[model samples]
Target: MNEVGVIDWGIVGAGHIAHRFAQGLAHVRDARLARVWSRRTESVAAFVQRHGGEGCGSFDDLLASDIDAVYIATLNDSHAGYARAALAAGKHVLCEKPATLNAGELRAVLETARVSRRLFMEAMKPPFFPLYRTLCEHLRRDPIGPVGLVRAGCSVANVPAEHPSFSLDTGGGALLDIGVYEMFLAVDWLGAPLDVQTFGRIGASGVDTFASVHSRHEAGIAQLFCGLDLDGKGDALLAGPHGYVWIHEKWWNPVRATVSYAGGRVVELNVPFEGGGLNYETAHFCELIRAGELESPIMTHEKSLRMISMLDAARSALGLVFPGE
Candidate 1:
């Protein structure tokens, strides 16, 4: 940040999520894409050409360059490594969800961020979306009582075989890739996961193709499911003693919600998003960087740890361990 207080960002992995990050970056004030790097040279070149960033020759170049932060948008397997390297290099890091392969791995990366004394936040975008924020405010003002249960799920069966979600080596599966979102909702509304029970099937690719998770949190219980071989509905529910909140289908990219109370009173919330849904999280990260915050108050490190821990337990129950685990 120079006199004008602008932040430059270097990105790892010019993949699908990275493209969304770049698109969202356009909506973040005073943040610019400084450098882009990925495994494939051609992908790097193409991404840079489309997204208005200089293509870096290698990851070392991207880190060594004079950038204020790093966004780890790589696959699940590499999120921890890139986040650790970025924080160790004295850059604030905003890594994609799951943060790492498992709770143990996330702990190591978080320790690195702590020693580095830099901001590190998992890119959990739902809380920042307008609809979600509105829901929080409404709950605070009107009261939803103590939320005691959370239920959510998302699954798609048409994913191509070549997609990384089916690849066991890259740490792809419905749990880490999709279930993490549901877990985040549970942890946010309920609390730290105390116990997790799961039932699932591992596909021929040696990865979990579908999973159903039932978890006990400090404050409540959660029922979540994720799959790459089923097309289940993708809505979410939060039940309380006095009422309930319903985040409509595709809740992860939430736009609408309804609150129903014990008195038969009802309220509907609809808040649209722009510049893609990822911008909200990107903007929040930028604000945290400026404020010298190490952990996000909303997307706290504790919440991330709890979410991934639930996934770890679920994976363990399913006997779906990635290589080198």
Candidate 2:
């Protein structure tokens, strides 16, 4: 509601992603945390006290506050519900990714946003970063010629089942938790694949511990894998008829990439981020809110839905299902 200044915002969760979102907001001069809310009263109180934010009694109370936007950092299952509530209450929403478990849930959230005439964005975070922007530009310029093949994977090891990250009920798994990032980056950069094949290891709890998926497109093909059982590395390589461009540490935060072209000519590109690389998205959200845009053209509702659809297909192929899916 504050015109000519930073937008007032309420943070809906006080978890790790909430912390990072708050930290990222710090880099933006035109956004202010108006309130903080969490079911855990003590946690919300602590977060408010540390960040100098007012403590709202409940998430509903936070929505009732005179805030322009609500950042939903809750669990995967709670994303749609929270976003729906916020949109209905006439507040813009920027939720952390997989924004919803499946395409249907995502569509429901987007429809709510449409009816309420409020903005809704998935906080995929990495795509809005400087590194991705640079990559997009380079690829558009055909810096590496036509891409031939791309190999992308995201993996981590030794995650305990007790952690909420491993919980199948709230939509936890290797592919959903981390693989989505790889899939998003691949599809975002290369467009939808003509066909996709998946293979992976599922845990006893009915969660995917490891997954390998091959995506074939008209231009080229991408091979993607993700898992928790084995300690693996995540990287994205855009190979062309002549050579390839390698994105180092691709999935989460890509800071550097090496481009190798014909005659073995190699060039290393570095993404020098000013802040946490989160500022780019934070700034983008603020800009969209100011402009009264309901969805980002780059990360549109359709894009989010399509990506989740792919995830659902992969899960189905793996015969993996969360508790109530």
Cα-based lDDT for every prediction? 0.93, 0.82
RMSD of each: 0.8, 1.6
What's model 1's TM-score?
Answer: 0.99
lDDT of 1 by residue, 128-158 (tens): 9999999999999998899999999999989
Deviation in Å, model 2, residue 253 alpha carbon: 0.6
lDDT string, candidate 2, 177-246, tens digits: 8888877766775677677789987787768888898877656677888888888877787787777888
Q: Which stretches of candidate 1 lie over 4 Å from their true place?
A: none
Winner by TM-score: 1
> By lDDT, who's the top model here?
1
lDDT of 2 at 234: 76
